[model samples]
Target: MKIPKIIHQIWSGIDGPLPQEFRSLGETWKRDYPDWEYRLWDNKKMVEFVKNEYPEYWFVYQKYPFNVQRWDAIRYLILEKIGGMYVDFDYESLQPMCEILENKTCCFSLEKEVGSNLFKVFNNAMMMSTPNHPFMQKIVKFVFSRTTLIPQYTNKNLTIFNTTGPYALIRLYETLTTEEKEDVYLIPAQFVSPFTGLEAEEVRLGVVNQKLDDCLDNAYAVHYYVSNWVKTNN
Candidate 1:
């Protein structure tokens, strides 16, 4: 089956109103993918979703120590149940998603090394798949399995990454059977990512040497690395 034409984005709304610039970044997705369905989820909607569609995982979802972990978990469940695409708000759309996806039914954006992240190669920042895809099935299953396991990282970000972020996704993805890996595409970094987390910060700080336009010639989107998960205040 082909991937659905929908986009899912979430915000906790804990930081007062969603920032105007964030909305502008998201508007790029809307403008580029005019026909795609758009779904913006908040903390309450996310909680209600779990209580409704994934009641079995409610305890685990609530038990997550970090809000970012819950953010990571919901993307998987959203794609598993709703299918389509989950694009982080920081990922600015440069072109229509369909054109960039190139007819793939399932695709995960790949990133270059991310500091100390073990699974930096496969980023969940932008993901596309049909609903009920086999890979996503295993994704949610793996998420549930980690509910009781504790990663021993001293840094909170590392802990979240290891447990429910890209680390967990790639770890589970690698263990899938050959048949289960079928139709799952690992997209190259330059196509969508185009920068490491450090490099992204440089871009954000406006200190990068290379002209931004020079690097994005082939990019369909650019992840600004807003990284709300890294902030504790919220």
Candidate 2:
């Protein structure tokens, strides 16, 4: 079956209006794929939906930091429940998604490596899946298991990352058997994130004067790494 042409984004009401950069990104997608559905979920709506559908996780969802941390949980839940593409607001579409979504049950992007520790880490910033794909189901199960073992009041950054962010997703992906791995499509970093978190600063400053590399010639989208800037500035 063809993957549904639905794109999802989250912007809690507290975040205020969408910035011009994000607005431009949304416009780009709309212009490129007018037939696709663009669905935006705010904090209130997301909370209500989770409460009704996954009551076991509602407490953990409510307890997570209201910032981007909660999105770690929200993205998986939304995708598992409805089955579609979830793109971070920080990303821009360089090409249409029709080619990427064609005949794929699920797909994830590789993070640009920062060091030996982060090499080959898969990023959840942009993910596409059919509803209730096993990988997503495992992610939800991972969240529930972690929440039980770790106290929610802990405010440590690393703790939050491990619990709901790429750290957790990476850990789960590693445990899958070879046969299970066949179900997932992994996009190389060059396609989804040609720039690492460190290089994002250079992109922001306009210091890197170069054209897109051949590796990105067929990239479907580019994650601008705005979240890295937000965390750094904080």
Best by lDDT: 1
lDDT of each: 0.82, 0.76
RMSD in order of candidates? 2.6, 2.9
For every model shown, what is its TM-score relative to the native structure? 0.90, 0.87
Which lDDT tens digits does candidate 1 get at residues 1-234? 388889999887866677888999989988998888999999899999999999999888888778788888899999999889899889898877566576677899988555675553787888998889888888888776645356588878777778878887878888878776767888877878887777788888887565666778788889988887676832
What is the alpha-carbon lDDT of model 1 when measured against the actual structure? Answer: 0.82
Tens-place lDDT per residue, model 2, 1-234, is 466688898877664778888888777776777888989898888888888999988777766544556667888999999988898877877778676567889889887676675445877889989998999999988876645345554555666577877888888888999889888888777777877775665666676455534435767777777773245311
Can you tell me which runs of candidate 2 are displaced by over 4 Å? 114-119, 146-155, 211-216, 228-234
Task: State candidate 1's TM-score.
Answer: 0.90
Worst 10 residues of 1 by lDDT: 112-121
